[model samples]
Target chain A: MKVKEIMTKDLTAAEPTMTVRELIELFYQSGLSSVPVVNEEGRIVGIISERDIIEGALPGYFEVLYGITDMNHLSQKLREIEHDRIEFYMTPEVIKIEEDEDDLTAADLMIRKNVKSLPVVNKDGILVGMLRRIDLLKDLL
Target chain B: MIITVTPNPAIDKIYWIEQLCLDAGELPVMRATRSYLTAGGKGINVSIFLARMGIENIAMGFIAGETGRAVERRVRDEGITTSFIWVEGETRTNVTLLERGHEQRPIQITEQGPTVPPDALKRLLIHYKRALNRARYVFLGGSLPPGVPTQFYQELTHIAHQHHVPVIVNAAGEALAHALLEKPWLVKPDTRQHTEIAGASLKTPREILAAGKEWTARGIEAVLVSHHITHDLLITCEGAWDLEARDVQFQNLLGAEDALIAGVLSATVQGASLLEAARFGMAAATASAESEELVVTDRTAIERVLPKIHIEQLL
Candidate 1:
């Protein structure tokens, strides 16, 4: 089977400008472990998994020691953090496969990369689908 | 509640090869390949198919080691509820090599699954008893693990009977033979498995039907025999029928049988007639055969082929 044969065509993608909070909500509503971070042209640029969002939202010990530490330095750091976009936190090195690639090629990449999913792209580098691990397993039976 | 019992489940690893050579190492590197993982077993396949068909069910089975963890992760990812007993051994992994060409034939290599100890088998049976208390249908499928008694399905069917729940047996070999004595509500054995169990070299539909009748007389409520050319033969308490399919472009044949069973169960739940259920099963199987992947037929595909499938009643 080819990547196009099993990859989910209807994909929920995240944008670079989308807030971490909004991304978390989308993940919850969609029940997807991760969402592809796409550009305005529908090109996959990055990916943000559930682990990334969870870790991003975690309360840091530095926040608790803000009053005890340098107040000016803390304020400046907080401002920089708030100004950072999802692009800054998202995994830039995205693993992707072409839609026409066969299943073995995609499986080998996934196994080698130890990834659960990969974005399926067209010739023009437009995101079309997401080839998930479960989709491949369906072919085995 | 519906409970699916998979005696032997595997982590299905599918590799899409450019061209599958007879030997794995000697294959020419002409094209690219890809792969994906899924929790696989007859019962697990049924559960996922049921979920896709909008049926809420819990999958129950024995899992072990890392492969078991992968199975759990994949199943949970699909949003299917599961309650499996973790055994002592590692779960098995089935490898499927799909060659992309004008004619695609999947080369499936299944591993010898984990062996269950006597105590582990005993624990599994006890868990089944608990699960049966609330389940209306008990689906048992897949092979028997090593060291476990061959009569495991028979015992489970008996338990289901005590609870007045219908049992569906999708198995072969000694496990199937022993389960037949318990008179399951449904027994879905493919053409090859049916011949193996009956010890017959029968290839014609008439011969297969005669064998189905023999099993029906032996106390099986229904024998759903799936064939290559024919649609399927449903030998039930009411009568027998030959389900014929329209010629279509065949793609991958993987998971066609499991999809058929799921389709039948869906119809049964909706109070459809046995013949109607058989028709649905045939349509679903055809849908799977026509798709390049292991998928259930959508409403459009089923409707398009429904009228073309000829069901001949034979009492």
Candidate 2:
């Protein structure tokens, strides 16, 4: 089985220019926690996830390393980044799988990258679908 | 009466979950503590916003299946007039999973809307004819469902112009690009849509101004560029104005643009000048962002922000 055989085709892609607030609205309306960020040429530029946003809103790594815990300050920080564009927080280094790639390849890629979802692109590198880890498992079952 | 059209409408389902955990080789199961189902679509949002502002408006669109019925029923319950053409397939359902607390970002899943048959499209146009006849402003919004041509909004705008009704279009991609040719009364394109139409990244107000000029040259009366709720740039044949306000922590950013549209329309209908209308639009957007409800009509909240708005007019 190939990635396209099990991947979800009907996707709601994100634009690089989408603000964090707009991304949250999309998440609330679509029930998706992560989205493939696509550029104008229909190429997948990055992947933005709920974790990425939460991390972006939270304190820096040094603060966490220093064991600074202030809930109110943390919440205030979240509000500050809410209006920032997704690209500012999105993981530009995305592990993508081709639509025609084998299910085994997708499973292997996910395991290697430790990513839950891999954007499935075509020969032109335009995203056509998204293959979740469960999708490959289901195909195996 | 203001008439808003949404060729594709859906039921927006919002789920508030405690946490989201996905395990490989296992089905992810999460419980939602709170949920909301609202009638959704770009035009529906505009109509809802207008109605909340005490403006008489009609929401016209193609709705189908049980979800469509539910959407129509819900909109009518909101005290807004509904004129929807019943189509064949079920209306799409969009899902949003929001983790508890404002800390977690939301996840959105959008389903493709039902395909509108040619007959249903014809019926919708006929309804538009009657609705446009009485409409002071016709708002053509959202993407067309499958089987509808990209030039759909262009044709609809032409019809509205023929009926002497001004049109405000909020669309993206080809729909927006095509409608610009018809010179709609106003076009509100968010950052992404503006970039798509301009085919370039617009980072500064100068780039935005140049793009606005390009669109105005095409005869569009006004180009409203909504920059992620941070700023709203309004360019007209007369002059250009960039309005900004202190960012308030938003409950939900949904319908902020619609709120802006409603504010501008409401102010304009009351015979306010273009600059005054833009101010009201900014205030209304801030009020909407201050609430979780899709559209806000808290006049007090809107008025509070009205004075804080800083408007810079570029001559």
After TM-score superposition, what is the CA distance of residue B218 in candidate 2 from its true location, in Å?
Answer: 3.0
lDDT of 1 at B45: 86
Candidate topping lDDT: 2
**Model 2: residue A100 alpha-carbon error in angstroms:** 66
DockQ of 1: 0.02
| Candidate 1 lDDT over residue span B157-193, tens digit each | 9989999999999888778878888999999864544
What does candidate 2's lDDT look like per residue over A8-113, in tens digits? 5433467787788777765654456998887755578999987788788873645455664677876787789988989999999889988898988888889988
Residues A22-70, candidate 1: write the lDDT tens digits. Answer: 5554555345678788775567889988666534544363355534455
Q: Which residues of candidate 1, in runs, are more than 4 Å off?
A: A1-141, B22-34, B101-104, B198-202, B297-301
Q: lDDT tens digits, residues B1-315, model 2? A: 788898898899988777777773478888888788889888888777777777878788877777977887688766676666666678899898777565224587888888877756765675577556557989888878998898999999999999899899988878887888899988887554346673734557787788788888778888888774568888998889889878576666666777888788888888998789989988888877777666777778889889768898885
For each candidate, what TM-score against the reference? 0.65, 0.65
